[model samples]
Target: MAKERSIPAPMANPETEPFWAAAREGRFLIKRCTACGKAHWYPRACCPHCMSEATEWVESPGRGTIYSLSVMKRAPEVYAVAYVTLEEGPTMMTNIVECDYDSLAIGQAVQIAWRPTAEGGPPYPVFKPR
Candidate 1:
């Protein structure tokens, strides 16, 4: 059997460390503002809506729909990338895997998955048909 190649893990800073750490344990974290009850992406320290620093990290259900998608046919291996709107109400950019690229459709049901990264750093979220 052929060996699989690894991709570089995402770089985590102070602001995103918690999210990445939780991902290592197969958990997805979302932040909800204590002030406005709104959730935002990219794991900022403050709520983008209320500008409040009291955001709390909460576990996500890790299910979502494909808000949009594009297949990169030029790649040596075909892959589809898309915006997934989580059940928690945040949209994140992710790769759709474990299926044919042409099978992807907007609003299709999906579930969050994790893939190991290069150099044994951490696993990152990907999406597969649910």
Candidate 2:
């Protein structure tokens, strides 16, 4: 098996600690605004929709379709980075693995798989073809 990469430690502020904890448990979470019924990423204390402090954390299905992608040919190694628009309406920056760089397409179905990190932080959520 390939060695997993190290993920950087989260800042661990009050707003984002719960999110980091959830990711360590192999679950993906997003902040949902109770007031406006909208979900958002990069968790914040207040809802971006209504600026209300009424927000809650909810588990995500870890499923999404590729919204956009870039093939890195000049970077450290050949890899693909994508903005995956989650079914719950938040687009997250993630890496797409287990597929050839030339084979990825927009709107391709993907499911999350946790890649363990050597940094002792949360595992990185990577997408693979479903």
lDDT of 2 by residue, 14-129 (tens): 88888778888889889999999999977898887789999999999999999999977753466678999999998999988887778899999999988766557777688988
- Per-residue CA lDDT of model 1 for 16-124, tens digit only, reads 9999999999998888898988887868898988799999998888899999999876534667879999987889998888876777899999998889998788798
- Per-candidate count of clashing residue pairs (backbone under 3 Å): 0, 0
The window of 10 residues in a row where model 2 has the poorest summed lDDT is 1-10
lDDT of each: 0.86, 0.84
Which has the greatest lDDT?
Answer: 1
**Candidate 2 stretches greater than 4 Å from native:** 1-6, 74-76
- Deviating ranges (above 4 Å) for candidate 1: 1-6
Instruction: Give the clashing pairs for model 1.
Output: none
TM-score of each: 0.91, 0.87
Report the number of the highest-TM-score candidate: 1
